[model samples]
Target chain A: MNTIQIRNITKAYNGVTALDHVSFSFEFGKIYGFLGRNGAGKSTLINIIANRIFADSGEILIDDLPATENMAIHEKIFCMSEADLYDTGLKIKDHFKWIHRFYENFDLEKALKISEQFHLNTNLKFKALSKGYQSIFKLTVALSLHVPYIIFDEPVLGLDANHRELFYSLLLKEYENEERTFIIATHLIEEVANIIEEVILIDKGKLLLQGNVAALLETGYCVSGMAKDVEDYCSDKNVIDSDELGGLKIAYILGEKSAIPQGSNLQVSAMNLQKLFVKLTEKGGI
Target chain B: MNTIQIRNITKAYNGVTALDHVSFSFEFGKIYGFLGRNGAGKSTLINIIANRIFADSGEILIDDLPATENMAIHEKIFCMSEADLYDTGLKIKDHFKWIHRFYENFDLEKALKISEQFHLNTNLKFKALSKGYQSIFKLTVALSLHVPYIIFDEPVLGLDANHRELFYSLLLKEYENEERTFIIATHLIEEVANIIEEVILIDKGKLLLQGNVAALLETGYCVSGMAKDVEDYCSDKNVIDSDELGGLKIAYILGEKSAIPQGSNLQVSAMNLQKLFVKLTEKGGI
Candidate 1:
């Protein structure tokens, strides 16, 4: 199979488990949204997949081949994390040249082209670039690499709205040009809602849900009306969360949405991706 | 006047200007969104208001009293910035006690209550907390202080969806309990659109626009249909930005939305805050 498969991967840091037998797979070509709450071990899983760290148990396979510490499959995947790995003293263009020499599949022409599109100055040193530009630099490298799988961890961390929109459009263009797997782990769910084809949710180092974005959004909805009316309508529904404002009430439900009764005062609305993630991952109190 | 009046504030670092004759007033008892692109001098202006940095020219007034280095007006305002000002060695509870002595209106009781509501372990040291928890601690201090003015610089930087939602509700509750000025500088425009009453936008160290949020959103809208239809409809309109995908087109326009023709296929929709900000500030090309 042309996929990156994980079989019971478990990792721990000083006896605290970060991944508890987390098993999942990324098919050959699809854009995925990897979502989770803080301290949910997203970075841990990404690092393990990139071979930056070792998992205590289980294995990662790429096209049925072992992925752990195997240089043969190194050119197949690229992970752009938040941590700065490039030399601070090196100029942007110089770093691109260095990466071209290191990775067999690195495309220097594409790197310069993307840099031009983002208006990134190639003459500036890594340390001189602002936080937003630094993110642009990292994403430029990820976009330039001809890898089958690329993971972007917080790609737009410090970007403004214009730059973020530019990045998304560029990503879509790249996806259209080639069939490759792109996994983005970010907190800005609403912005990526329309871009990602599928979603993989993790909570407490365990896989909670994974499916098509449209299918998942279809299951979650909101029913709002007068306080008493909302309560009566949601009495038999699967209410995940709710809010009350004086006489107005809204109940967030997770299940097949039913038709409103005749002369009912209730109104139905689709639950957005961010709301679904929050309601499913939130534990206990506020 | 119960407001923070910035009178022709001008500041520069080295030879480059950060804020050039920028003037604006944040009135009392309302939430305002301070929005701008990266390197647009938001932090520079915020630091001047907080008295952490001085402006080369002009003055800041709180209720008609000079705010720069004025000890009398210090207690009237509190700025919770991204930079950490607390002692990293001290426990959360200990830090709260220390803050109690620094500010005359510090409410220790409210601080403890807010911490408990966030499920923050007050016994843990500042350095021991994660990035999300650190943001929560900073916000807790800001909420506990009974000041007439408060500024939050990227308050939700490392926070997850649940925490961000919790912070927004807490902020609204705080505003409801006491009518005070709250200035939030964030890149997440859509999330804060409904919460803010007014908006202050700056670009390239200059004030671009400032007005009521509802009025601003009402002025910006989008017309979408066939490429030719959108072009024809927007030819006389104030089109700010546009996108073309195959045969479809989306033209973002700023002005009164006129009624479409009886046989026209163009559809008009309200423009979102993020799109408005992007179209207004984006220059040159993608």
Candidate 2:
């Protein structure tokens, strides 16, 4: 069953629309990538679903019911934003205690273990921790919340390579055990492409594309060959973008692989999500 | 001529070594990716070179002369770190003015233009800006500095996808026009791999690998084939890592691609920098 649904949701601030007729439904027990360019209303949509912000029109439903600012609905969903979650004056240990008390599903042991892995100092105040450590702290809290639907907006911002990998690994483990739904909004598309089951692309406050990850990849291909060959092959097709490096030309095109012309020496491969995002956003034709 | 040089630099805090015997020299006009796992001394190394911290031993020289907190050397090198750079009370516009007055090469017009692209509020107090906008402000300053050498430590941390791409495009344009040296320390390796001419990998306070980007890619290859074929080809080689999907197996190995046994149905491709990094660091072997 779909865990969350949004229908023709629209929001505006001072006559500037932040979300316009956005509609999508997220399934349960799957990981989804909420992707978009900057100011594409990803955060706005998430906030509206979480009931942290009001939409000007339409409806949002959680668990097949209207999702207003109801405490029960809010309890089942957790949205971890990119901004620092902890108050500046609170000590790390105190913050942990507060989270434990606030969320009935909070796993204190798991939080402690994660803190140990990250080598976080519980005595240190929020402002005293390094940026990387602060991110780790917030990640631990979010993971331990154990909500039915968890949303992470750019969760690995300050994490290093090792920590970032660990975050994904932990998410996978949690998914395997609990089967909860996860929505991740991030620009690091390639890194998480393998982990996400579905992708939803938003652009300029509107829904651009939404589908199964594998299905999207099947239709989007990157063709590389000689400049003349690529130009000729892409002339009649939807060539989203093209780039030349030395004598080789690579064109991002939308079509079946069988359509590629013979004798072109073309190497057609699935487009990495980041490359696809760049091409689509630049062309504004997704 | 080398723009910056580090010779056997070592740094410690309360007897805990942050950087150990690190040595590298950056050329005058190339983009370098300073990569490492968390706590691998990337920041320590850059901080020392920027004269913000002192090395316990060894020397840092810019233009063949020691970079010892001297105004002449400092003025030519710009280091934009993830740390907060502005006083809390100052307005964003005032901070820009302060930076313009302090840095002789700062371009006020370019800074203003970048601010507009990022949609930053010039009237907002430094402390009032969102984390993302704060990062944008710092990036704008760095772009406008126009220094001979610039070091950016995770400069795109809070930026959205569109702004991040814009930053990269602007960086390329700046490099092409001015031929300035730039060292970007980031965990988002794949995003910058295309633009970086060289890469420096660090792990646990030690240098792991350093080489030209093209040469590094040539050092290893990814071989994909049937499970048995992949296993047989990788059995006797230095298989850095391997992943299996259904009936297909892919192995990342160091050594010449031609060394693989014939009749293995092996197809070899270049290894991605990010995948290689995860394999090398996460496994603790290369």
Highest lDDT model number: 1
Give the per-residue lDDT of model 2 (tens digit) for B161-204.
66788889888888988978988998888788888999988888
Lowest lDDT 10-mer window, candidate 1 chain A? A277-286
Candidate 2 lands at a TM-score of 0.91
Per-residue C-alpha lDDT of model 1 across residues B79-159, encoded as one tens digit per residue = 998678788999999999899999989999999998898888999999999767898999999988999999998888767
* Model 1: CAPRI class: medium
Per-residue lDDT of A112-166 in model 1, one digit per residue for the tens?
Answer: 9989988899999999997789999999999988899999988997788888998
Tell me the TM-score of each prediction against the true structure.
0.89, 0.91
DockQ score, prediction 2: 0.58
Model 2 residue B127 lDDT score: 93
**CA lDDT of every candidate:** 0.89, 0.84
Candidate 2 Cα errors over 4 Å, as ranges: A119-123, A259-264, A283-285, B88-93, B116-125, B259-265, B283-286
Worst 10 residues of 1 chain B by lDDT: B277-286
Top-scoring candidate (DockQ): 1
Q: What TM-score is obtained for chain B in each of the predicted models?
A: 0.89, 0.91
